[model samples]
Target: MLLLSACGGSSGNAGGSGGSSDDVLSLALENTLPGWDWRKQISAGHVGLEWRPVYDTLLRTRTDGTVVPNAAEKYSYNEDKTVLTLKMRAGMKFTDGAPVDARAAKFSLEGFRDGGGADSLRLAGVKVHVVDDLTLTLTLPAPNPALISYLGGSCGQLVSPASLDSPTLATKPIGSGPYVLNTRATVTGSKFVFNRNPDYWNPDDFPYDKVEFLVMADETAQLNALSTGQIDGAEISLGSIERAKSTGLRVDSFPNVWSGLFFLDRAGTKIPALGDVRVRKAINMVFDRSAIAEGIWNGNGVANSQTYGPISPAFQKDLVDHYPYDIKAAQRLMKEAGYADGFSITLPEVDHYNDEYSAIAVQQLAKLNIRAEVVSVPRQESISRILGGEFPMFVYKMPVNPEAEQVSNVLGPKGAFNPYHSEDPELNKLLAKWTVADGDQAAKVYQEINRFLVEKAWFAPFGNPDLPWAFNGSTTISGTLGTTPPLYAFK
Candidate 1:
């Protein structure tokens, strides 16, 4: 991929497009954004650009794990959590100066549902109804347990009703966000320059007068820009933390993603050894999760070997030690399962995680007589190999979403990644309980389901890697501080 030449003057020690003022904040992202269309933008690279500055969600999630209203000033739901009613703030307007009212609210929410995007799954069976200028109601065919959380996410964001029909809005967005795109100053697909939205309802929230987003596919390039002052901030990997802080950049880190092996052939469809539960347990018992998390991930990840991160709402500390590294015990189990000499399996080559983790697993599993073969292929081809069920094990990073409906699709019966597309009657029942239940009720149900996965050895979760973010200086952007810029507060 070709990179755009940096605009403005020398990479000075200041900020802004030309390094002239702090009002203009420039940041670097690891990948180029797909586009400005929220319904179509699924990558995390474009989240911050969409969530806080370019668009506004009906609800917003804070760093402290609270979900509150943003564009929708207040909201309510029925007892079963089926019907949702949203009451908008008195005076919000799109960048085009169009009033953001109930009709526009319905249009935006329904737009996402029918947009054929990744998020449409969240809005399944959702129907939007406009009640009045400031009120809109969302009806669901059944209880949507994760409705509030989704409403607080990218899928629930509202675009400008004025520009909803414009084909250009896909490449160029117009929302009631804190910033407005300055097309003349932007080099589409490379860098986007946004001036503070003067007509924005919440202009006082984002302190910066200007903001610039640069798309650099190279991590080293992002850090280089951060070092030379070409950009004020860059989201980097754990490998770059010490190097970045050494250069006097402020590093802000958090837990963002979980990594692990998905045993796709649990029923022994492709790998007969996996049909036996002992084989799977033996695999889990073979990992020194702590060492791998500390050494390979560089202390940037937690050692909890479960799909759910320690910070996740569904996490149960008692289950954190579900798997212990005991090579002798693992070997014994393998022998009992008739794989004493070990078995070989193919894993897709995922450059980011698979290559390194699989290499480490090979060295460890060798003690148990397990032979591992990792094949390198294009990213999509590797994904197809797993989705097509041509492989036994898959290595990748997946979000530990607390939503039962969402989590179930990946780990439940008919789960996309479940080994052999397996199903546990009791576990499925618990997942059903979790979906309709919240708070302590839901947590209890999820606890049972999580424990079952561990006891059954359904997954070998490697835990969430700590994410690192380094910024040159601080501005008034206050709220969640990770990759996704949810809500901002002006100084």
Candidate 2:
């Protein structure tokens, strides 16, 4: 299974709306909403799909990833790009009658920054200030072009200042978006119902009068729902592509995520063999990415050696398959690293990932005399076990976001994925250059970093898997880079 990180929630019946198909836009999500708390919600995967309709972001991104104004009509940056100013649309009010002003914007931004959301780190060291009723400013510690992109996502979602401190905020949302959550009709973990906001400033933008999301974890059930007209759209796996196409549903396929092994023990504190660059390169050469992409992803993806995806500015065409499958070459490297007799390593078996990939990887490593052990852990405990340094390596899937966001989340010294906090002076220097550079200079620096990561064998990337979304004839959805498009994109 191609697993995206999601929070587990209770399961319940998917109650029907009993309304005409034209009036109600129904969709199936692979998981339920973690909660209504904007501060706790993840900005990617299915979670964003759930709550975005009820919240208006300060900025929105086009399908091509360009930042455009949404709730905030205008925005600007300082000369050094360290200060961002936002001008909110006048007379906007939340569902509960609270004005969506600069104070509310500052409150929401500060709440998210301090609330420990999955993407909260994006707002770290940033300060929000209210310039006036219609304007606000964000002061950054350093120049970060990616901050605008983050605003286009959950980090930019605004909440009512009146409800921000309410205990019921976790279950009820108060925002100025085009939709209002129908809590009476919603069943926790099963179905979510939304009613059209009569007072919304941009009513024509959202065509549906009523929106419903059914949580269907199983792909087969999702396919059944789509075919039977129970839902208008859903995200399906690669294996279900043919079945979905046969049913006349439009299958939108695009490369959005990358899956493979994350080598977290580059410093070799826990796993000595993994510390050596030669052994890491040897491990990268052992896997035939072409076969894995075809076999595991059903030929829906292309073999990739670098972490950067095609949509990213840092993506280099020549770096797609930097390492070819060559057992002899891998053996030579192992010998050079003084690991001719492979060592033992333990990998975490999280519920989110399909064990088949790990099994195949273990079998392949056995050829080099490496003894690998898999320890099964619950999904809730997986992050703590993996990031807490309990496991040196693990197979996982991650989003291919913009170059700067990717660097901060995965490659930077204090990145969330960098558990051991491994620091490379050369990599740090490149990061500083990329942060201050812009236009062609920024792209060049990012590409250089991508090449450096591949040459160093920072990760054993399998490939970029194609994400397929099936929509009925009545619904039209556009694809976005790195993530599923926001709920408003559905028409």
Candidate 3:
């Protein structure tokens, strides 16, 4: 995802409403808003486009990878960076007339940390304190470089304290955002309507008078809606790419997700052969990454040496060539590790695409004397199996965060997705240093962690998925997807 500017993409020259009239954009969301409280969720399924109109966050992250105060006007931190302070603008009132003060913000943030489902991880060790009407402080157990980024992400969106008191808050929320959910035009579970907030703080920034969110999980249905002018924007499936273009709808494409093979036996506790670094390196060297990327995904994605996005600064082009496919080298490594006859390994796959990945892997590993057998497991049991060390290797999709903290968590021993149960003490110490480091120090630590993971063959990286977001030609979008956690602006 792009660490985008507040102004997303350049505006289209296509003559349309130019955001006059109601400027009510009917956007299709992948899932229904299970609840209205931002604490429960701030997005449909973490894309966060649908959550913008109803709430705002403390900070807004920019394309230049810097953060500017949004609802917050000023901020400070202690010498050690464990305690952070933020000053909110005075007189910022919610649509329901409650003051958007430090106390209220504290309550809102606490609600999120206590019950934010998946997002609870973002504020794990942080404690919130109301200093005064304008001042709020966040105390962290450890230094966090991405705290500001997290506050500007989906987890950062805040709701009004008054909204939480409402019995119908799960369906209707009162917020300080630029729009109010209009029940008159809304249909439960199918469609939602948001009328403009008359007393919104930054009225000039919000061009639209109304915005509508619809649960449109079907790509074909979203396409039909776009043609009929029923919706203005929707997330499109890969199969709908051509149809969306044929309809003249503008498509915004970004790095979707990283799908690759993960090594779970770095310690070789379950798989003794994998304890040898040569054996692990051999596994990474066996696959022709270029062929796997180009042949399997076609133009949908580009071959990536590491799991990080291509645009990320952490990506080291210099080291990408280290693991180029060489059958002779792979065989040598295996034989050096006393596996000249190859070894039998079981790989678990949940999805149909991964099943195909298994097939290709089996064909390649056979040549190197490694017999790879794939076992199909139900998708629901995949995570448990991974955590339980049921498989030595598995095909998986890793979400992109574009932040050091995310990678830190994933590569660390305490990470929720650390399926490998990786417990390298040096790695842990490096991560601890990375966690506290700032700017140049942080960058240096991150690069080391990123490089270490790749060099150790922790993951056999593949390519980025090309996720295309379809929008009607009538709307001129100025903001990019996956930018600010709240909402993209209308150009």
Candidate 4:
């Protein structure tokens, strides 16, 4: 659950410290935003999430986990769970004064359905029907109980019809959000200023008037800037949590619903060492999750074996005790796998977690007779290379929905996560049950799948680190932070 700080009122406005008449709020991050075009890419760094301030979804999720209407004033469902109707607020317009009527909503959704160059493959199957100037209908091919959660996702955000028609709008998005993009600067560093949208639709709900984002790709530079007060807040680095807290800055951290690999092994790969399931389990047994959580994250991480959490009532808690660090048992397994001689394996650069943490893994795994070769690369190139099958083992952080159906996106056919080529008829069978089963059955099925992943040694489930952030004592931003922080409420 999210713990809202009853700290005094935000410095001033939703944009920055309230007392300051200057509407320009400066923010800083540790990396350059991948792109400004929300509809053109997925995982475009924090800025794309920042775009939530520019784009509006049909519904909004509050820090309390309640859903509220945003662009749409109301939405209803039919008895059969096939048709969903959304009603938009009348007289709404984008920042450029372009009417954000039902027609524009229809066009934007249709464009996404027809591949609007946006990275929205999850919504590829949705069929939309505009009922009238005030109502929009979504007709699903089959009954989907989790559709509401999907609608509340970042990819479901609405775009302007004029922007959809104009190809150059990617460079300058015109949104119905509370803040409008002011200047997009990219010289020595990347920066953008957001001015208050005076004609914003929800004045009572949105509090801030302006906000600024500065991209600082270098970790050292981001830390320096935060200490010098050049920026208000930043995502906490692994080794800097204690330092941040000691400075009187608020350090907020929580266990995210995310999982990463300590190691991965694909069957029939060149590295015969990884082909042995016992060897993989041996490595998992030797992994020191507690040390990583304490030494690296400064006690701001959660020890997890699999991905699901209590947030999803369906999460299986039995799996929590599946793996524990036992060097003796690991060595026994290593000997049983005919690797008493210890073989060499490449520990490629993983871009998902703190680079220093991955380095720590390489050092720790060496004690158990598994000789590791470490290689580092840029984050983008590293992701592309790993997904393209460049290395045998790698690490990645996956942001997943808290539902069994959406969880299939990773383990399903052609899914990005089946990197080890793990396939089972029974596993596929359970995924198909998502359409017909309710929460109880879905939980059982996902539990079965979790057991399968563990037994097969498909991937070692390590700790799910709590996402930590350090904000200036004077500035405040609203949103619940998890694996992937919801950015819609970030004013």
Clashing pairs in 2: none
lDDT of 1 by residue, 132-175 (tens): 89998899876656577667666667787766688897667877
Look at candidate 1 and give me any clashing residue pairs: 205-490, 300-466, 342-369
Our tally of clashes for model 2 stands at: 0
- Model 2, residue 424: distance off in Å is 1.5
Model 2 lowest lDDT segment of ten: 1-10
**Per-residue lDDT of model 2, residues 160-269, tens digit only:** 98776678887889988878999999999899999888887777667777889898777788888887788888877777788899988889886867888889989999
Positional deviation of residue 82's Cα in model 1 after best superposition, in angstroms: 0.9
Per-residue lDDT tens digits for candidate 4, residues 52-94, read: 6677666665444344566777777777667878888898888
Best candidate, TM-score-wise? 2
Model 2 segments more than 4 A misplaced: 1-20, 341-356, 374-391
Better of 2 and 4 by lDDT: 2
Question: How close is every model to the real structure, measured as TM-score?
Answer: 0.82, 0.89, 0.79, 0.81
Write out the backbone clash pairs for model 3.
4-63, 5-63, 8-478, 8-479, 8-480, 9-478, 52-486
RMSD of each: 6.9, 5.9, 5.2, 4.8
Q: Which candidate should be chosen as best, given lDDT against the real structure?
A: 2
Candidate 4 matches the true fold with a TM-score of: 0.81
lDDT of 4 at 159: 73
lDDT of 3 by residue, 136-249 (tens): 999988877767766765556767777767998877777777778887778977777787777766666666666777776566787888877777777665556777889888
